[model samples]
Target: MTRVNHQHSKGPHEMPATGGDRPRTDHGHSHHAPPRSVEDHLRAVTELLGRSPWFGREPVRLPLEQAAGRVLAEDVEAGLDLPPFTNSQMDGYAVRSADTAVPSGLQNQHEQVDATAGNPGAADSTESLTSLRVGPTVPAGHAPDPIEAGQAVPVMTGATLPPGADCVVPVEDARPSGFHAQGATVSVPAGQAPGRFVRPAGDDVVRGTRVLRAGDRLTPLALGTCAALGLGDVLVRPPLRVGILTTGDEVVQPGTPRGPAQIFDSNATILRGVLADAGAEVVAVHHVPDDDDVLRALLAPEAAEAPHPDLWISSGGISEGAFEVVRRVLSGPDVAEFSEFLHVAMQPGGPQGLARVDGVPFVCFPGNPISTWVSWEMFLRPALTAVTGAPSTRTEVRVRSGDEFECLPGRARVVRAHWDGEVLTKVGGYGSHLLAAAVGVNALVILPPGRGTVPSGQDVVVRLLT
Candidate 1:
């Protein structure tokens, strides 16, 4: 495990410790808890995710065509050797190498040794076996009869090698080219070695060898490999089912009319796309208001009859407001366990929470659009990736800042920025609600905590989002 170093202490986002059951207050709105470091929060989230019911579920078989992008759940062994038999690697004549020997094919007699495995010393007593007559041509797909000791069989590329012929001499190398009827003598050149131009059986993959292992995400190449091994179907893990809920009294659906104080809901839409890209199946997406009773009833088991999601994700209503519906309704011991609701040492995504409602995992994000997006990228993406063996969500690059960069002294700053393959420059202001500018950028510049200023051209760590 890679150890993450995180500084945990009282920072700007923390409120005075709220003793007992009292809610911590910040600017008159009740707060959840004190702050934790980003690393600590990620560790907590990862630990909780490790306990999920689907972690070790049995694999399900799916057709090879439908298995792409799904994680392989079982190791696949090849049933038969690749190519399945010895075959010609070129358009050539299958011939015994001794017949083409440089010393007129009589070396075996002098050595008194056998070269052929099953037939011993047959060449020792025979006449110089060169310039043999051509036998029947062996085209692809039609198996040829066994070749006599001194004869050459014409074979095409990918044609199976005939028994008693240990090597192939290309048609170009044989005198009087092109395959002809029996008794037409074709001279084979010497120095043509055995096993040359022959694709030996199991050269690519041997039977009983495990070619594909569990936890591998099936790419097109991986699927093709399984098909090459003669697999009609493969065992794969199921995509995670997630239920997304976006809440706030002032938030409305995008297509609906909005009042003066209301804004179009972007959290649900953004998260749905992010989760889908991460190989999660978004089973449900809903908008919830600040009314606790209405929200509770909608989440109750009776209301959720079908399509139970494996996980639940919510944005807004997790911060320090009295009208925090998710906090107010589900904070009790009876409903669910709200494990940690606190600020992390990170700007734009400081507020976060985790819960378990009716045995289903729930993750809560702050209301700000950019903050919600950053939280998903930093926390949920990595944890889920570890489970699914999906490719890494972020691409890290060391870059120099194009200009002077500013950061909050006590909190790590994740600034939306544009990276031009060389230098990174911050885009828009450092406000969490600046979604318009956020969309224009392609990466995030992660500034560590307690470092307020970065001089121009200073090296920094960058995480590519696109």
Candidate 2:
């Protein structure tokens, strides 16, 4: 197990004290408090979002085409058996197993027995191969007629088996490998077992079987299964409606003119993609300068349009800085219901805040591009999984480290890495600002606090992003 260093931090399950417990600095920012463990902040976010109205809203019926990535609100049962009836699994001759049986002494004989050639007991002869008179052909979708004793019915793949037939001899195994006309004789091997090359009814899925359970995401393949079960639409949990706020005076939208000291805002793009991947619907997005008043007005209830978000997520302006617009506005007694600003014991995403703004839950993250991405992956995505069982939950695996890396003593080190199945290789530098270097990274390698330096080939825990 990969452990997070939490020696000086509180347990992840413990909620931080709100309001008066936080001492305010002269700049209106909360005084630095002991950093909380990564798990601690995650639990808080998960609990808050889980209780929101959007998470518990009634399920909506959506066509399979529109239900991709949505979680099922209820179990899906099959209306009918897959294949629906006993059928032939190959193009062959269907016959009674007893008619193909040969005496033990003749089992190894390579000779053929012609039952219509004056040999009254040819079917039971030890000196000859079993042969049967051919009946009418059975094409797919056609109701086949029953066969009599010493008779063979040609069947196409997926064709329903005739009532009197107990087994099929594939065309390749018949002495004459092609279909025969009515009343023709076809020679087959003896001692063929019943049910050979035959597909029993309900072989794939039985009627009334629970094929999909609640919380199962409607992926392409999953939707195909639903279609096979005769379902045109499914009941799915409503997507989480989210509002995003990106703050900073130095951040400008991409494709707009940029000042010498300002950079393009990547946080918005990053958040939008990840939120969508997590099955959330982005209801609103705004980039606010480091002005508390402007931030306050944007968050005001009446200012937001319909389909308002059930939660608001702001990036930047939550760290300990002089002009932290989000922290300043959301922390004010008049605008906030309950709020806590604290640090989590994880690099690149340590600064974190949880609050309620205008009765809607708010989660605040740090501003750096990589920091924002890491924050979503480490905190918000996991919280969403906990709340709605969304399919965005990442799969974690333990693998050998392909590269050696240093770790801080009291905070977990989250390194961008590429997992090539056999080993996890570091992708970029540990600095949160090295966003460009993070390209091609598919996993996050987490090293617990106090481990210091990990040697190559050592086992480490990794969360797959792809």
Candidate 3:
């Protein structure tokens, strides 16, 4: 129900169409409708979205390194506390918290395989460090000679605790030469927290703790947590693949310009980049002349991919034009028909909306340079949240309109705009053909139809692009 205030600017989706909403195909004619508006189109899509289902997939194990941008497939429970052992926090000394002072490496020579996961039938096979010699100056991995009673040993960072040692004193706390050859020991103040300076086995994440859950995105921090737990692989959901179809007779590949009316195809390329940035893989983009049969054949590639894209997006064609995809798809009586006309009431993108043909989801955006771009930002972007596991829309901010705006009287207006840190200024004259303006602009300001112009300096909400 939001309105655009700009009255002069128009986008391609404000296309003119007859009763059928199909235009002249052979002639490559455009359409224009007097009744529909951008607001109306947005409403229609919103209705369709409410009925759409979320993405679906099963989990599979992937290396933590490769899990970025993937959704967690299942809940991950910790196999053990992070360090899995009583270990030193510093390179200095280990002492019994109660003893106030102790010998270092009293049990440094002891090395044991972790058998915490017990084999009940073979308890004796479970290796545990019961006794070891106290060591002085023992490196972290090597074992020291057994400590005689009341003896201290040298230890280093990551060294195992000697038997009966409960705390570690940082080297700074004890003089380096103060020890009698036992890797230096120092006194502790009374009541230092037990397990102080020690990362308790499973303290970061305890054994059997649910560390991650299904639906969680594999972010950098999340990967770091998994790595700390010694995980090399993780289970995550499959990436969403998308099919991009660019349809039109006037469009030709870049560097192959023909007549003045023949423009290079920027929509497909732009759409591809946007789709990828949104986390949906562009499985393929099929370029087709305005023909129904040709499009169906082109969609074959999209269908061939292991998991078909949840959504199919086509740029251009949905008006009451002969070349419109919506019209051609709905032409057949063999179960694939778009029951609704291009009936959105919004301007510039009024002709754009969703359709169901043979149960495949499709959204159509206008072909005009700016219309195509605007349509995606307005309709498809929000709907993509489910497909990509990201938010439905990009970030938006409120800024002062640099000039009073006049838009179509009844339809909502979307104006490509530029936003500096302090203000949002309108871009080049609002026309679908103004590609240069669209390029310079970082956002589009929505002006609800029927609303009066907002004077310069008035606050307006602007959706960011790029």
C-alpha TM-scores of all predictions: 0.73, 0.87, 0.64
lDDT tens readout by residue for model 1, 1-466: 6421111112335332222133422221135445677878788777767666566456689999987778888888899999798999999899988666767555654323233423454454322225787888889999889998778899999999998898998887666556778768886655678999999999999999988898888889999989888889999888777889888667888789877767788888889888877777788888877666666787787888256777788898776655566665666555575455667878888877788877778888888888888898888888887766764457888898997778778788888899988778889898877777777788888888765689898998899986
lDDT of 2 by residue, 43-139 (tens): 9899878667685567899998899999999999999998788999999999999997877676656565544455454465433457889999999
Q: Per-residue CA lDDT of candidate 3, range 1-466, in tens?
A: 6421111112345443233244333211124435555545555665554443224445568898777766787887887777676566766555555443224555343334434333344445423232222236546776444333433345577766565666655654443223335433333233334576665666677788898887777778888888877789987766656667776666677677555555567778878877766656676677666566666655544545445555667777655554475445543444244445454555466556456554556676767656777777777767555444543357877888877776666677888788887777888886776765566888878776666677898887788875
TM-score-wise, the better of 2 and 3 is: 2
Better of 1 and 3 by lDDT: 1
lDDT of each: 0.76, 0.81, 0.60
Q: List the residue pairs that clash in candidate 2.
A: 12-40
Which TM-score value belongs to model 3?
A: 0.64
Worst 10 residues of 2 by lDDT: 3-12
